[model samples]
Target: EGGVGYCGARRLKGGHLRGGTPAGAGLSYYYDPLPTNCVADWFCLEGNSRHLPPDPLQHPGARPDLNLAVFYHACNFNCLYCQNWSFRKATFSGGKVSAASLAQAAHERTACICFFGGDPTPELPHALATSRLVAAGVGRERRPVRICWETNGAMQEAWLKPLAASSLDTGGIIKFDLKAFSKEIHLALTGVCNSQTLKNFAALAARLEERPDLPFLMASTLMVPGYVDLEEIHGLARLIARLNPNIPYSLLAFYPQFYLRDLPVTSRDFAFKARQVALNAGVKRVHLGNVHLLT
Candidate 1:
């Protein structure tokens, strides 16, 4: 295990690994160190991050005064409606930073470090390295820093454990974008198979009982007008319920973006129906995100 590992599709020569190598490099589109309101509605739910106190020990929820949103550039999945697709150009062009500097950006006021992107799969090594640094540097008096990942769940099986370990240790959540359940639908929408995503989600679900008080894994599907319909919702919800019904699932209202601009916004009726389908499927906690986008 010490001599071999992976970062994205590239394998690392672990024995030959050194500082400043691609294995330890992270390319972020930008860093938002401000404590702005989180865009995800479920994150603000009661007993989550709504009213977190400065003292980690006193957290009724886990909101930090400052959240560092580290937006990476590369992604493994090429979804047709990627909202952050424009930034993907930076994947190879520029925007590289060291894990230490990124960790240092999390000053005393910063309480959360969220790694998202096009998707974080392509840059997992860098994110993990940065998280290690951030974790080690937290002082006793400083508030607990939560490490969260908003990913496509396409990473290899080996990386899933470490990703979940970091979240469970820090009281953060892993939000998997379950684009579609049906293999055919998934390939059509994301230009890739959904097998890896589904496999990785189930692999992580096996660890859910380790931490029951705080939700360790969460799933969300963008209600893409005609593509992600009732059938897709039903299948995905059933999968989640089967794995662990307690895992919170969110149905996001899709806004036409990128190549899928012709489609209309998710309708209000559809969003409500999707929630019902998930609830009926045995999921105890379900949420509707971006309700404003619903027509």
Candidate 2:
């Protein structure tokens, strides 16, 4: 009885508010002391950085799919509710890497690359070089690999065209996250208008039309307080449906993680409404995040 004595019954609170690793009192994520690269005059060559820990979901055993996460540092967009804020800036470590080495490190079952923060578009030149390396290895074996390029979708066509081309034969999965739909709301949430983003999406649509076999997924997300709008969500759904009904839309719940800490998290009701609105607007697969796991 003494050995089996029960401690007090206790409950932990706030999993929704606690996924991201805390930094200092003010900083959202802890920034490691990264060494700067000497040659990059335009941007700081901060070594690879993270706000939360590396996405554990990417590791081999973490998911049987053998997925991986490539965290690129620095970003062109300044999304207010960004969970991975520190990685949103240009850092030497996160930008360029051995794509070949990465592929060499990957297994054949790896379906997801989980391309993530700092914006990957700027690293395209490096990514191209890296992809060639990975392609040399996995391409020979015909592995079922996909490049999950998570982006703000604000980069130019030149960059995207190459990326699109790379994904063509390899059957890579390109996932883009448009911050917001309307120009004003878009600018408010992401700190820039994605007119270029919309254009890039149109091009992607045209490309997918031409190549029905192309593997691509266009998605969008809205930050909680500043940018959630039915009209915008509906507009995005309509645009994607007009392009392709099978297109999957991911409706994420925005929490006050980064600069938007002052704002309350997007309520569960709001998230549900957003998903329904997307479905009503004709989107096929709208998955919501941030709430506790559903029963």
Candidate 3:
């Protein structure tokens, strides 16, 4: 029980070893310190300057020009349409990078540190430790570093606050990929129930008023041609709007890939209709991503 147990798609034991330290973490394969306009504008939420580096004069690299993208190689969901499915192969392959090393990568210029992968739920200890390291490294001139998480939102209830606190204290946003609303459809697509995901999302949304200037939580759903229809979007949107209408919702166009390769790309007509439904459901801001993927 102490070493190696299967947690969904990830092997949890040696997975946390990094740099020969027992508590060391790993599986982070890439680190990019450059800016990507490809990065979503939602990240440009106002009032973020309130959480800027401790001392800009001392930390000259404290500009928001770059976003440190830390890629992990594990996930809890088995979504048939996972675009980043290749991360599965690296799950147990061994690339234990120390949390300190990863934290160092989030230098002064890092506008934000985004933790994502197949999804970051599986290897959260490392992410949290690394986030703490990053925050501490910034020192106490003001707030913590902006650390964002693009996750499946299936993390255990115990980890929710710490994860949310990391982002909340640092002016970061947690983007939850709400795959589908209906139990049957969600189970079919991701092989996991939507209950935990939805619960975690609502729980985090409740804290929105804590930081009104910056969006505390955001949601996105992939428009998987035949699977995620307007109905699913409508239902999901209603849920979000009911909890907090102001929460930013992004409707992503899906491309045929992984087990869902037989399906066609999300159509432009469908994308527009989905947005209309979400807005009508009372979601204040709705964005469409991967428009180029629209057929």
Better of 1 and 2 by lDDT: 1
What is candidate 2's local distance difference test score? 0.56
* Candidate 1 Cα misplacement greater than 4 A, ranges: 1-26, 29-50, 53-64
Identify the superior model by TM-score, candidate 1 or candidate 2: 1
lDDT of 2 by residue, 222-269 (tens): 536546677777888888878776665677666667878897777777
Report residue 118 deviation for candidate 3 (angstroms).
1.6
lDDT of 3: 0.78
Record all residue pairs in model 3 with backbone atoms less than 3 Å apart, i.e. clashing.
61-108, 61-109
lDDT, each prediction: 0.78, 0.56, 0.78
Candidate 1: RMSD to truth: 4.8
RMSD of 2: 16.7
Give the clashing pairs for model 1: none
Candidate 2: worst-modelled 10 consecutive residues by lDDT: 19-28
Could you give candidate 3's per-residue lDDT for residues 1-295 as a string of tens digits? 2354333333335446232231554456444444343224545442234434355544454444567777777677889988888877876666667788888887656667888887777778878988888888885553456788889899899999899899888878888999999989999998888999999999999999999877868998999987899899999999999999999999998998899889998889999999999999999999998888788
What's model 2's lDDT at 93? 29
Clashes of each: 0, 11, 2
Rate residue 82 of model 2 by lDDT: 76
